[model samples]
Target: MLLQSHLRSVNPDATTIENAAFVAYRKDATNPDHFIPVVPSESIAEAPYILHLLPALPPAWPNGHIEGLRARGGCEVDVTWRNGALASANVRAPHGGSLRLYADGSLSKTIRLGAGETIAWPLP
Candidate 1:
């Protein structure tokens, strides 16, 4: 897809995802270094299926950013940044998802994500 590389923004004019057969992420959620597979989805049965480029082992971490992840439910999630440590970083809701985060063994805050949306939160 033609795209513009920038932060906190997707050039809607240039950015677009199409024909994604299914979403896949690491098995050991939170651990970027894990296996990922794109299986068919029962949720989106009528949706078209198109397998994009197969994913490969992540080479590095995004500031402890779980290197790899799969789109569970329907919405995709991400932790823009964390203060120290991350306790939870996964999205689990079909239409909209909510996830809790913790740092230094302390509950950070609750995160809510909408479908096809990216949320940036601060972790204590």
Candidate 2:
């Protein structure tokens, strides 16, 4: 089967085939037997939306932005996950400071942390 994969070629002018033809050998390898090619799904046309990245850096590499779930102060931090789900954070956020979190690539919550806070989340 001719499976046309949607790989981006650097040279756009490159041609792989001018026509589609299938050659098969019969009983004594004398002639051709014909069949057709089928594409199972339209999903092959392009990559899915998330053939990319998981949004934030883990808590060890704290980015002090709302997009990342890390400490905003001079506090130590740790993040934990279980079975691809966010489990908890060992955060020492200063009073009135907040921790941000993402779920399925969207900003899910922003939590106000008391000093020496340990926070947890339920898995979906």
Candidate 3:
């Protein structure tokens, strides 16, 4: 198999396809994969609605106003991936604040939300 061959070349004694694929996919500098975000459901239960951000964003959306589940002073976002790329995001911010998107320890994007607003922001 291609995975086994790749692994054998990488590590003579290695045998797991999952690990090999993860390393290869993540280290592919030419076309690195998108970072996926994880949101805890319990964090924003009553905010309002969910923002479904797609790879292709819509033309017009309200400024800093998104519909989502109302929560505390923070925001919660969920990510969707397709074919190793980011597909969409569902963001919820009840009290309104800065929603920062990060890749590991690096900051990627920042969005500001109004009170009880939810946004689906597309990431590049």
Candidate 4:
């Protein structure tokens, strides 16, 4: 329910809007039922969004408990729209990275590279 709460906090309109979809997935194969939301594509389209990572605890197995283990990390997505297009960036913490987009109404191609990265593609 943390994800639901988080989404509510980030986008209040989401609660009132219909046709919004939320999905979850488990990162570890051993715990298939342990699902969590990974990417919120639709919600991300909403400007000025926030993403939170919840705390983690090691799973109990064979009647044993373990401590000192913590969840990987978390991120907060901040989006802004300008001139009839959506522009946003993701700020990742504990490990830092960012994703930005420059979109137009029709079709557009943009390549982003960071620190010794190379990308090749075709434009249509």
lDDT of 1 by residue, 1-124 (tens): 1111111111122222321113454476767678777554464443322111112213343234442344433444343233333324433344665433322323323356565455433332
Error of 4 at 113 (Å): 14
- TM-score to native of every candidate shown: 0.28, 0.31, 0.34, 0.19
- Candidate of highest TM-score: 3
Kindly indicate the candidate among 3 and 4 with the higher TM-score: 3
Over 21-100, each residue of candidate 2 has an lDDT whose tens digit, in order, gives 11222243343454444443443222111110123445563322222333223333445554444445344555434433
Q: Which parts of model 2 have CA positions greater than 4 angstroms off?
A: 1-70, 82-88, 94-96
What's the lDDT of the predicted structure labeled candidate 1? 0.34
For all candidates in order, the CA lDDT equals 0.34, 0.34, 0.37, 0.28
Q: Write the per-residue lDDT of candidate 4 for residues 1-124, one digit (tens) a residue.
A: 0111122223333432122223344455677766655765665543232222121212331122222222222333233333323333222333332222112322112223354342211122
Residue 51, model 2, lDDT: 10
Cα lDDT of model 3 by residue, 1-124, tens digit: 0000111112222233232112322334554566444443453332222122332323442123223322233555555544434445556666776544322122323356788776653544
Candidate 1: residue 3 lDDT (0-100): 12
lDDT for model 3, please: 0.37
Better of 1 and 3 by TM-score: 3
Question: Once superposed on the true structure, which residue ranges of model 3 sit more than 4 Å away at CA?
Answer: 1-73, 103-109
